[model samples]
Target: MKHLTEEDLVLLYYSEPEAPAHGQLHLRDCPECRGAAESLALTLNVCSEWVVPEPDAELGRSVWAQIAPQLEVQGGSHAKRHWARHLWGRPRPWLWVAPALLALLLGTFYLGRVSKRVESPVMAGLSNAARQRILAISLADHLDRAEMLLTEISNAGDSGAADISSARYRAQDMVDEGRLMRQSLAEQGDTATLALVDEVERFLLEMANSPDNANAAEVQSIRQRIDSGSLLFKVRIIESNLRTEGQKS
Candidate 1:
């Protein structure tokens, strides 16, 4: 016979009304399963002694009185008895499923709010000059963070196991940021801006895809590319120019 799962034993021990009949049959014929069920029962019996706040008798009666009318409304005793059986039959599934559904609903609503804010109408309503200022400011912030991530990796000292994991993840995020900014610049036919953004994305992709626990040699190789190509210098200059132009607008 297959050994009973802990979940199966727990439901049997608790004597859940909906516990499967197969479980009951297995417990009778299977000594191993029966022993497990007995141990679980002992544990649960101990837990049942935990102290719980008791309602005042008067309040309990008053609350019962209020609900009694509703319960009585589903026809007389026979109809009410069937309703009661189904209501008490299996509440555990709903205990979990209800909260999961509620959380999913809340998550969807919150994400919708964030999406609206990111695609804000305020930016869209701005004049052509104002829009450039907004783009410049947003692009400047993205480049600043990207430069920091690259600089951190470039300046990492040759040592034992260097964890560039955080930098790697940040660079991944910057790749997405750069993609969006690059698209904005492309719409304006800004070749210079687009070229620099493409270079930034290229290096960011390299950093993001690399292993987190990079050794000293790996760190040096990345830094060498940045140095040889003046990648960091170009980003810094472009970021500064965007900020300067943003201020003028």
Candidate 2:
């Protein structure tokens, strides 16, 4: 018969070292493999020299006795099973309800902020209308002053008349005032008023830049433009609106 190998003997020693028949008979008859298997067993035995110490007999019995009473007091094994069943029964409903309530509150807060931003423009327009009325009234007053200065300049006989210099200076001053009021009206968000202001500003700039000895022709041309542009009519409309708003307020 074929002799057993060292590997077969080693496996046999660990698995069934106390076997009285089959494998033991083979190892006894197989002298060469038996020597190799015996060497390997000796090495394993030397490496396992670190032994785990057992607790003292009294200490082991005390620990077991203490744990046994506590376990019994807690209803023993039934407590763990009851806890596991409770958790398994209703956990998913609580998990969904918490997140759903949080999402609803967040959505309500977000919509409230969005609604406020949407209404801001309407509120701003109402305030802008009030400011526009005030600016319109101021512009009308400035225009009246400008018209008086222009009339004085038309009546002057020559550029060197005593009052001519003063009249020219006053006329230029009035032009500057008109330009400032026009700029103020533009900022008030009244586009119709701003447009009329712009036209008046351009006319004033032209007249203010003319020579001290401005001709009748130039003066008449400016007057014609002033009449045809309906600037006076626009001013009157603005004044009327101001009065109406003031009455309401």
Best by lDDT: 1
TM-score of 2: 0.37
Write model 2 residue lDDT over 59-103, tens digit each, in one string: 978978856643422211111233324634533323222223222
Task: List ranges where model 1 is wrong by over 4 Å.
Answer: 1-121
Predicted candidate 2: what Cα RMSD to the true structure? 40.0
Structural similarity to truth (TM-score) of each candidate: 0.51, 0.37
Error of model 1, residue 128, in angstroms: 0.5
- Provide the overall lDDT of each model, using Cα atoms, as 2-decimal numbers: 0.68, 0.52
Query: Model 1 reaches what TM-score against the true structure?
Result: 0.51
Q: What is the number of residue pairs that collide in model 1?
A: 0
